[model samples]
Target: MKSSHILLLLSLASTGAAAFELGAPKNNNTDNLVWTGHLSPDTDSVTSALIAAHIYGGTAVVPEGINPESQFVLDYCQIAAPKPLNDFSQKAVGLVDFNQKTQLHPTIDESSIVAIVDHHAIGGAPVNMTQVTPIDIRAWGSAATILADRAESLDIDLPAHLACTTLAGILSDTVVFQSSTTTEYDRYYAKELAKEAGIVDLKAFGQKMLEAKSDLSHISAAEILTMDYKNFSYGGKKVGIGVAETLTAQQLLDRRNEFVAAMISYKETQKLDHLFFAVIDTKNKRANLLWIDDIDAAIAAKAFTGQPKQGWLVLDGVTSRKRQIGPAIQGAIEGKK
Candidate 1:
């Protein structure tokens, strides 16, 4: 390892993120560490788990089945997806992509978490983590960026498949750098990973990935809502947010009645105080927000600048749910008396 990179690791050690060690297992523990991501495994979540396990000596697992985009990436790279982990009881685990209790498996024990490498905000994470636990939580766009950075710093050359998949993870999470959540780290590592993956045109590769993601014709309305869904809490109000990106936004909008019915059922079944679904046009860089009813629409109106058009809240040039939609809804809910 280069001196600068070694110093970088030492710097991380001084901070709370000091659990990463290259070479053999810490204390010669022969037990295999299990790495996983959030509940609804997207491209970033699944790929980050795989990258984390490969870099840190563990097996990658997913809480549930992965999305089409993730599956497409894995298949395109000729890499096997992680096996499903129904229960994480008493297992030595590492988390990637998300660090929230709501996102974890119901059977996961807090003490079982050995490490966490994420790019989202820290909320309801395990507080009783061991002193030597590695907790690398940054504000980067994707967890893959952080793990790829570690591999680069340690001079650990990832195989071509992992490298390509890592690049796919970054592209998926950051929306190919179109999302506002993207950062310099994401961009830097994206170029490096693209080069290592032997991808000639990064944007072309991303478009192919999005093409796979947009092929949601066969999935049911409920499945489409939850495929990329996440639950959040704001000011004691339970909220569920769902986003669907497609090249043909009109096709998804054509099924508006079905989406509305599904949204109503989802909100009621989940007992959520607020629920909003956005159909993002990946090519046009816009979103059509879907709500269940008047009450849902009223609440959603407060969050986005979009106006209602043909029973959809049309957000022009708004392509990000995490940066544009989620936070806006959070602020709207929290600001409410």
Candidate 2:
């Protein structure tokens, strides 16, 4: 891209009112490098991209959406967020938070990826490969943990609020250290990052961050689903699972009809085979899995072995969807086939 177009793109990323949603513009330069997160970027996704960009000497760009808590941290730390990313064709790119092709921007050239740091499931197997260096995706709680390890090893001094911002990703992905995937490294890194961030109380800070993201007012049920959703393909079946964490499941239950209606519309529009959502009670450690019909409801029960009450499945001890829900659903589907 020319310097003039670069200036225009950067200006839009930083200045537009709805700049994040602009996707990516066309006919841009390819020589530039970008570290990008997944769609509806959470704390880990955003922080991982930012930290990786710094380490790899690239610009960290936002995905399609930003979690409310991440936005809060950016505002709190007075950090300027990189603009949202649209197309990745021709441009050098590094992916964080997710490696799945569906979660990536469609226009992105997977061959352009030089590195990927994620903790979720891999996309479909790579077809011929070239330079996919440092492709690290483990079963850890947070992708931030991976980058945090690097920073500590390098003894790098983080910018203001950078540590805290990255810590939020670890806390959120680990459900404040209550997730089944939480590792010893995650805890140790949290403390290390807390010291760098000048955080005195970890749990209190985590709770505050969760509360900041639990706000559902002025948001439709459809928005809630797409805000933090994931797409999966198992046995040639397309599955869309959206996990929306909240301190108050009751508030969401109040709009059961609205949720079901939205789910039906979304399923039709997206042409999905299995579409489901979970409203997690992060404070109490439970979930209410919502569905549009009986088949989907039955699949939920088979997936998590939870009993549905009033069109909602009450799932206990199920915090991380990566461990608990996705595998269960894939099992259910395979078992039927």
Candidate 3:
């Protein structure tokens, strides 16, 4: 609860995000359910939606652009990222990876969000819980965990590739069981999923999957900026954070200027008050927090208690944004306020 952090948070508190609303007026797509994940969906988002679509018969809406690892996963599974969500004529909607209205597609009616499967903090409930036949939202390691569990409980037979992809989602979100948010249920389900998916060596396949997720070659700086990015309503302030899960932190540092410029442009374009881009070294289990302004660097320094070098905050053992970066930043903001 540093005074500077409090003052900083309070100064920007008035510019809060829209109030949380639960129900949207009923919409046209009540009979045809369309499912989607948050913007810039990663493995968990993509896989969870795939499973949901398979079981429930909804079209899985892909985000605007797909990342390399996500592309790799989709290709490996012999599937394609569903076409972008342009037409919203479907009757019902299901959200994955996130629950906030702001995180959904622009044209998607909140009333149409009849179901959801998410692992993040509950934003507003997009749909009335009582009205939705099945709503799965929990603070687990990954949304993949919830959906995979559901498939098993219901005795729904998932295709082999789908199982593998679901397992990939679990490994990615949990950082192969290294993240703090991981629970026993995550481990239990992961083991079951790995077996179901016909993965012989967990270590080998997990490493291969992680490697694929870390590949960012041939992608532009601007595209990289939004890769696995998410925005949060922190006490009314719009806080945006992005992550690059590369094999090594050095891979991003090599293009620091490009990354920084992209982030700055993205922040201004998105009208975000605060933005942070974390470069994760999955190989070494370390990270570097990059930001444009001094306040952001200072916040990262305090949040991770890491050393600030130039404009980047070097963290010794930081990886999971959900478990580490998100809470630390939120705490710094709230504690100071």
Model 1 scores a C-alpha lDDT of: 0.81
Q: Mind sharing the TM-score for model 3?
A: 0.84
Residue-wise C-alpha lDDT for candidate 1, range 23-99, written one tens digit per residue: 33344232657889988889999999888777777789999998999999999899998999897876778888877
Compose the digit string of candidate 2's lDDT tens values, residues 92-208. Answer: 777788877667777777566656677776533231224324466666789898777767655567875788878888998998998889988789888988888888898888988
Error of 2 at 326 (Å): 0.9
Model number with the top lDDT:
1
Candidate 3, poorest ten consecutive residues by summed lDDT: 1-10
TM-score of every model versus the real structure: 0.89, 0.87, 0.84
- Which regions of candidate 1 deviate over 4 angstroms? 1-32, 123-132
RMSD of candidate 2 to the truth, in angstroms, is 9.6
Q: Which sections of candidate 3 miss by over 4 Å?
A: 1-30, 123-134
Question: Best TM-score goes to which candidate?
Answer: 1
Instruction: By lDDT, rank the candidates, best first.
Output: 1, 2, 3
Better of 1 and 3 by lDDT: 1
lDDT by residue for model 3 (1-337), tens: 1011010011112223222111221222334766678878788888888887776666777756666777777776677676677656554677778876556667776555556677776542333332333345666789888877767655688888888888888887888887778877678778877787788776677687778776676778788778888887766778888888877567677788998889888888999878998888887877788889876766665666787665577887888887788888877655652
CA deviation > 4 Å runs, candidate 2: 1-31, 123-132
Ranking by TM-score: 1, 2, 3
